[model samples]
Target: MTSPGVHAFLIIVRVDRFTPEEKNTVDFIKKIFGDGAAKYCIVVFTREDQLEEGQTIDDFINSSDQLKELVQCCGNHKFAINNKLNGQPLKIKIDQLLRMIDQMVQSNRGKYYTNDMYQKIERQRKREQARQEEEDRKKKKAYEESLISTGREIGRQEAEERERERQKEQKSREKEPQKTEKPEKEQYSTREKICGCSCHKYPGVIHVVPCCSGTKFPFSLLGP
Candidate 1:
């Protein structure tokens, strides 16, 4: 349907015998092509040999309500041809069709057929595509932002956990009991001052000795 796009659409029909389905095609064409469609459409009738003597295309139109209505819808553009006939008759029909085409072209100032509805549809399609692309871009940006936000949240939580651990350790150290030891008092004993044979009782003659030093009296000190 999209091939080469349509410059003009030919609607062929058997003038003498029209089926219900065929008659409906006219309305369908108009619907698809829109208002400008009629200008480029031509009603072509086949089976022209079926016409009785002196019967013409006008006579056929006058005879059939469906045909007349279809022609009117196409702006009264109609032509007839008989492929079954040969020589002069076929030539005449072909010539008549060409003349009608010429007249239509001239009336339209040599403009080719165009479908306003098709163009409108194409424009709408472009607009829709652009809108979809914009939506996709917004979604992508939102996804990236979400990832960034998640990362920041995770980093903050980790930092807070570390801070909590540090505070817990500080509080533990503060709560621990401190140990203190008092200085011990030295014990002194009054001993008879005897050094050799000149020892005399005197407070200055003796010095303070540590009890854990394994010391003995003066007589033991003189032994070795």
Candidate 2:
């Protein structure tokens, strides 16, 4: 089916097994074959024995949706193959089928499908496949880059959050140190001094004599 440069495409569709999938295959095959797919295409219906008792292939075509669509895709070109036919009748059907093929070839300027055309088609298909692959790679790279960018953004946000939390903790610690601090006491106090004589220093008050003003004496100098 992948072979290129086919002048004619014979779509073998079973008369009895006609289904939507078969009908859909017509469009798919055309895609695989590319341009000039329809002109040389033919729809050959098999299993003609399953036709209604008095009905011809046309009757079947008229009754079935899949058959109608198949015929339409092949430019209304359709034929039936019944191997059961023998002698002159079989020959006649064969001749008819050949004549139709001949007409199609003739219409195509007697150009039969050849390897040269196939090679050309194949090369073109390869080029297209390469292009599509490149495009897919680019898309994949873009998607990956987007994921990395998103991850970086998330990491940056997380780092900022951690820094904010750290700053908040530091501020809280600073306030705690202030709140738990004790009142400042004087390093040097004159009240710690007393007279060296028999005079006792007033309680919690500073009383310095003229002679002991320069002296740092303990209040125990006045023994009880």
Candidate that scores best on lDDT:
2
The whole-model C-alpha lDDT of candidate 2 against the native structure comes to 0.75
Q: What is the C-alpha lDDT of each candidate?
A: 0.71, 0.75
**Can you write out model 2's per-residue Cα lDDT over 1-224, one digit (the tens) per residue?**
33344557788888767667778777776566656567788888888988879999898888977677778878888889885889999999889998999898888888776676656777888999999999999999999999999999999999999999999999998787445678798554445544454334544444443333455465543433
Stretches of candidate 2 above 4 Å error? 1-7, 177-224
For residue 194, model 2's alpha carbon misses the true position, in angstroms, by 9.9
Q: What is the lDDT of residue 187 in candidate 1?
A: 47
Backbone clashes in model 1, listed as residue pairs = none
Which run of 10 residues does model 1 get worst, by summed lDDT?
Answer: 192-201
Q: What TM-score goes with each of the models?
A: 0.47, 0.72
**RMSD to native for every prediction?**
11.9, 5.9
- Alpha carbon lDDT at 206, candidate 1: 38
C-alpha lDDT of residue 154 in model 2: 100
